[model samples]
Target: MSTELTSREVCQHLRDAALGVRPLQVIGTGTGQVSVDIEGWRLQLEFDGKHLHHCGHCCCPDGREWALDSRQRFGTDPVSLLSTWELAQIEGLLRRAE
Candidate 1:
């Protein structure tokens, strides 16, 4: 079964990967995006400043993925998309575009 994770869990998992705190860890970061690979998931997230822009995830590297946004409020928003920084503890990890 697929698992649903909190923002804090996402942030911590990424942090651990970046710090090489785990045996199986792969991570990459670019201008406004970060990619991570977990045992059964691949996650890519984009951010504008401290706000999330987009999120993509799939069970397999070459499989289908889903898109979701946590920063904008429009029609047909996914449930529980807004993830607060307070809960994530990633204030310093995310930065504004220069």
Candidate 2:
């Protein structure tokens, strides 16, 4: 497998990490949330019918959160939003994860 991951692939990696040995959980019909711990930082992302929201708690100022709409922010492209968010928050930690 390649070290670099697309946004969708990164999301999958997070899902795998979060679900390790735990009872499978679904956020909604199609929406889901995933949080992964890398080093001392926790990265989190959530997607729903309309938007994809992400937070980099460690890197944010005063623990503030950020969210982006799939349509307005990424032109209805989820990969763009997620990938961009991942890079912004953890500086490519998701791609580096196993």
lDDT of 1 by residue, 1-98 (tens): 44444444444454553344632233666777766465545666665456545455433433544555466455322213334533243323444112
Scored against the true structure, residue 51 in model 1 reaches a CA lDDT of 58
Clashes of 2: 0
For candidate 2, give the lDDT. 0.37
TM-score of candidate 2 versus the correct structure, residues matched by position: 0.25
Instruction: Name the runs in model 1 displaced over 4 angstroms.
Output: 1-26, 57-64, 68-87, 90-98
Tell me the tens digit of each residue's lDDT in model 2 across 24-71.
222223235545443322345443323445532221223333333344
Give per-residue lDDT, candidate 2, residue 2: 41
> Using TM-score as the measure, which candidate wins?
1
Among residues 3 or more apart in sequence or in different chains, the pairs in candidate 1 whose N, CA or C atoms overlap within 3 Å are: none
Clashes of each: 0, 0
For each candidate in turn, the TM-score is 0.40, 0.25
